[model samples]
Target: MKKLVLTGAAGRLGSYLREPLSQMCDRLVSTDWTEDIGKLYPSETYVKADLGDLEAMEAVLDGADMVVHFGAIGDEAAWDKILHSNIIGAYNVWEAAARKGLRRVVYASSIHAVGMYPKTQRIDTEVPHRPDTYYGLAKCFAEDLGSLYWDKKGIESVHLRILSAAQVNNPRALGSWLSYDDLIHLVQQAITTPITGFCVIYGVSNNDRVTVDNHKAAFLGYRPKDNAEQCAEEVLAAADPADPHDPGQMCQGGPFASVEIGFSGTASMNIVQDKKEI
Candidate 1:
């Protein structure tokens, strides 16, 4: 690919992706609302653009072969904030990609989109959306938008419903954690896959206790290397006694299942900061 555009380039996950993504394409256009990302890799070029601005987003994606869209509120918030950054932002990316004739869009969707399901009931990519919060609703919208674009415009997309892409510091994370190495692997597969016309895959490690199934997305060739079970003992020891009846503890979505609409659920997880340079 000649060029690759990455939104949310100043974020924690984006920081780790920049160097790898830059090496894959001749020119890596990294964008975020932030003015700077501290430093840049050889093929990286920073561009500050808001996801809410369709014209500005189009300008940034003009010459890109593919787009890895990660820009958004990245939190549970008021409906207005989510509507702008997550909902409208998703539409803009898809529209811009279609107009530009990009190869594909790699999206950062979340497990919260199906948070209402019980932990015992393992879900696959084919499961219907069961959003738990407004933030989750936005993810469902984006996933559906990806589907619509692929069916109507022939634009390819790979939506990764990330469970928990953070440090494993609690019991819930033992089953849901998506390690940094695995995340890089998943993104690489999403980009290199030959034909991904609206594919959905679980963004999780190869944990023994995993609640989500990725068998249907085997064609994408996303074989994760890391496992959260390595930290299981420590995490379980640190966790408070879990109530099996509590939705937060019994649901596959963890804290997200118990949170009210527009409230923060990720705040409950004790995720450690990434040590990677941004």
Candidate 2:
């Protein structure tokens, strides 16, 4: 790849991706709303850009072969905030990618897009959207927008519905955890795949108790190697038994399923700090 653009470059996940992404392309443009990204790779360039601005996104996407869109508010907040960052920002990305003639967009969608489904039901890539928050609703909209752009404008996209890309500290994480190594592999597959019109795949490790199915998206070649089961005994021991009637515990999205519209579900979980070499 000649040029690759990564949004939300200052974020926790982006910190791990920057160096590897820089290696994949001749030039890697890392952007975020923040002014500083601390340390930079030799081939990596930093830029401050907001997802809400179409012209800014267009400029950043120019000459890029592909885009890894992880920029957003990342939580269930006010509708106004979600509208600008997640919803409008997503449209801007697709439109910009279409105008710039980029090959593909790898979006950071969340499992919250289908959060309302019962945990007992093994959801698949093709399952209908059951968003739990305004944040999740935005993801669903962007996914549909990706599909529209593909059908109408020929832009390719891969929407990865990540379950839990954090430490396996809770019972739900035993099935939902997505190791950082697997995350890098998943993104590589999405970018290198020969053809991906509009694909949706669950971003998860090969756990013993996985609740999501990726059989339909076999073409993307994302085979996760890590298993959260290694930490299952400790996590399960720490977890309190779920009430059968509570949507939060019984649903696939876990805490997100029961949180109020503007509350932060991630705050309730103890996520391990990411340690990346600067």
Query: In order, what lDDT does every prediction score?
Result: 0.91, 0.92
Instruction: Return the lDDT, model 2, position 142.
Output: 94
Query: lDDT tens string, model 2, 81-198?
Result: 9999999999999999999999899999999999999989999999999999999999999999999999999989999999998888888888999999999999889989999999
Worst 10-residue lDDT window for candidate 1 reads 269-278
Residue 35 error, candidate 2, Å: 0.4
TM-score of 1: 0.98
Reference-based TM-score, model 2? 0.98
**Residue 46, candidate 2: how far off, in angstroms?**
0.5
lDDT of 1 by residue, 86-185 (tens): 9999999999999998989999999989989998999999999998889889999999999999999999999999999998888888889898899999
Top of the candidates by lDDT = 2
Off by over 4 Å in 2: none
